[model samples]
Target: MKKIILFPILLIISFYSIQNHATAVTKSREAYEKTGNVIWEIKTKEKLVAITFDDGPHPVFTPQILEILAKYNAKATFFVAGNKAERFPEVLRRVVKEGHEVGNHTYSHLITSKITAVKLKEELNRTDNIIQMITGTKPTLYRPVAGIYNDVIINTAIKNGKFVILWSWDQDPRDWRNPPANQITRYVTKGINPGDIIVLHDWHGSEFSQACQTVMALDDILSYLSSKGYKPVTVSEMLYRSKTNYPEPFYPFR
Candidate 1:
């Protein structure tokens, strides 16, 4: 009787341990799924870089940035928040009219990791609707607020028919901190290479001064990139032009 009880107890303990270990492994994989499953850059030998701006369609600064881009005969991608797009429909329209690409940056600029799946879908769908209403074309590219994401965010975006977009060469320049325009330009242009996706901001909430600084830096940044023989293209264009086989819209996970 002692041996019989011991054998069953040992089997039960082994089963419990195996279950716990599997649970731990699943959790670990989910956590790892957050950061690595994003597209940072495209592989290409072509002298092209994609300059992207987020939190924009600002009533003031967006036009200035567009003017600078036009002056350089360069194209870029603007990841506009739905709220901002609704507020500044003309600005958003100008972004499309001027031959630049538009991307969805969520409806309310909510952080993806902090929201529920339903809320995430709402955010993306709302933004897509607004963009489609304004531009007659929904955005296929999606950039998460603050560049933070997770498995849920990625899956939600893909489900909503968006390709998750992140930058490859962020050298942020802390422009949102109201740094000098030259500093912002240096941070972006320094060590910038082909296939790099640069992130700049055209809006800074109520900080009009910081927005002005971004505009100020644009001319210099454009000039530097032009002198280097680097043509600024939209993210879609970069991906299409890339020589390497990049996964469409999402990064592959093993």
Candidate 2:
């Protein structure tokens, strides 16, 4: 009787341990694949770098950034959050009017890896709808929140007929941390190469101060890129002007 009772208890414990271990292992695998599967940069011989701003349409900073871009006659791509765009439709309109490209950054900025396929589709579609409603243009490019994604996220995006974009050059400068403007400028301009997709943030959550630093840094970075004979273009333009047949939809499903 004791042996029978012990056998059942041991079985239960073993099953629980196995389940926990599997969950941990699965999460680790997802992280590895997420970083590995993304496109870091487009391979081309053109002197063009696509500057992409994410999580934006900030009422204050976005307009200022646009002015700076205009002063230099440069174009960029904004990966805007749907909710933010809806809240500030005028800013969205200005972005379109200024000739910059817009891409979807989801509706609520939820981390895509933690969400289900159905939830991912909803997030993307909701944002795409808002962007279309405001700009009258459907965005073909999608950048995942926090730059996190899994197989489900990628597959769902492709199924929805959108291309997933990740930056080739991070140019982070920890601007979200509100670093000094010169540091941010240096981080972007230093060692910048052709066909590099640089990522910057125009909106840092609810705070406008961080965006101020980004604005301050923008002129210097743009000046340096211009001095280097690099033309800043939208991601699509960079790909097209390179005269190379860059792969679309990234890796196709098998």
The window of 10 residues in a row where model 1 has the poorest summed lDDT is: 245-254
Instruction: Please write out the lDDT profile of model 1 over residues 1-254, one tens digit for every residue.
Output: 99998999999999977754442111343343354335677678999999999998888889889988999999999999999899889998888888889999998987535565678899888999999999988788899898876666777787776777878646567676768988999889887988898888889766364347888998999999999999999887888777444334221111
Off by over 4 Å in 2: 1-38, 205-211, 246-254
Overall lDDT per candidate, in order of appearance: 0.80, 0.79
Query: Candidate 2: what lDDT?
Result: 0.79
In the order shown, the candidates' Cα RMSDs to the true structure are 8.0, 6.1
lDDT: which candidate is best?
1
Which clashing pairs does model 1 show? none
TM-scores of the candidates are: 0.80, 0.80
102-202 per-residue lDDT for model 2 (tens digits): 99999988853556677888989899999999988888888888777666677778788776777864555667666788988988887798889888889
Candidate 2, residue 97: CA error in Å? 0.9
The residue pairs that clash in candidate 2, if any, are: 40-168
